[model samples]
Target: MSDQHVYLEEVFSSIQGEGIFVGVRQVFVRFYGCNLRCSYCDTSETRAGNPVICRVWRGCEPGRFSETLENPLGVDIVADLIRDLWSPSTRHVSLTGGEPLLQSRFIRRLGERVEMPFYLETNSTLPGAAVDVAGVIDVAACDIKLEESGVEDDHGVLFKRSLETIEIFNDSDCLVFAKIMILPKTTVATIMPAVTSIAEINPEIPLVLQPVTPHRSNPERLIEMMDAAGRYLRDVRVIPQTQRVLGVL
Candidate 1:
């Protein structure tokens, strides 16, 4: 394994809150840094340099108990922690980030050493890095960011790149799915490109419409969004952030 260390925000076991793998137990490895600035992003703290402290679960107890360690933690140390947290029902170690592909090299090294399956949660804007690490991942939980979301980059440029990344996953045997966040003002016009992109690539890939948490979610609007998606895609569903509803981390 490479000796390169990784800057982490946190590493702990939790049930996945959204998308296809909702409620599946996972050990989340949250890295720092992202390329975009979405308007409703809640994980604002994961936006910068290596954290001075990393939070990790200390024991196998059912109740939450965590301990802190210095940042830029070693790969071997993280691998050991993964082993410590392993269990029969544990699905995979999810590599989530402000954008995990930003640190693709570190992820490649860690994935090589860890025995558990690697689940990648990415923004789908880094096609090059997505291709670099896609073969090793067991699942590609990608996002189709909308223009109205207030991203930092040019909307078309980022959207094209995300589509390219999705196209890569579309051809792979590895599971691929899209997570599109629906805002109050979100309409069929805002969702067509994302829907058409997946349809043009491979229509079988699941499309998940996740509503922004703490917003006034109109059921009728969600159905309309799903109807918009069904025009181009086959399997479309509306799933909210269940972890927030269940009051879990």
Candidate 2:
């Protein structure tokens, strides 16, 4: 293993208001940096330097949490933080990011030492990187981006690889959930191919269709995509970002 430490943005405890684990209390380790620039990202602040303080919106008053240490913590130190944040109410520890696959080795090391189940939230653009640390994660929440989001690189190949990565995890003991962000520009005609691909793999796997928030360039597209997705996907459900509704961080 490399002796070098990996960069980490911040670590904090919060409720999991998205995906299958929605409403569950979780300790979130948000890693800094990302490979892709999704147009509708809400956590743009986390894309830079190691996060030292988190501005949390609580009621009318905003609260702040500070981290004395620097970014990119070593495995041992990260382990201790996970333990400190672990509570009877905590269901899982989420390794989120600008993109978690960017620091797969570091996250794998942290998962190896921690006792609680580890969950990962990824954009599903880096399948090979994700597979490298698949053993360390218990669950993966992957997002499939569409043209409306401005991610116009070879999405066909990226989405295919994402499914391959999901299949890899599905063959294992890990729980995998495929998520597609429904944008105003995303229509059934645009996303049907991707949805069909996922259904072909394992229809039993939970597929989450999340509506793009009002902040996006297109809000009406969300409703259209939801209706379109519902026609082909039996397990599809439309959910907005609950954190936004709750007005929390």
lDDT of 1 by residue, 29-103 (tens): 888888888998878888865578877865433346578878788889888888877778889989988898988
For candidate 1, the 10 contiguous residues with the lowest summed lDDT are: 57-66
Give Cα distance to truth, residue 87, candidate 1, Å.
Answer: 1.7
Candidate 1, residue 43: CA error in Å?
Answer: 0.8
Give stretches of model 2 more than 4 Å off: 1-4, 48-63, 215-233
Which parts of model 1 have CA positions greater than 4 angstroms off? Answer: 1-3, 58-65
lDDT (0-100) at residue 19 of candidate 2? Answer: 89
Root-mean-square deviation of every model: 2.2, 3.4
Q: How far is 134's C-alpha from truth in model 1 (Å)?
A: 1.0
TM-score of 2: 0.86
| TM-score between candidate 1 and the true structure | 0.94
Candidate 2 least-lDDT 10 residues: 53-62
Name the candidate that leads on TM-score: 1
Write one digit per residue (lDDT tens) for candidate 2, span 130-242.
Answer: 77888888998888777677764776777777788778777777898888877666667878777777777787777787877774545466566656666656667666688
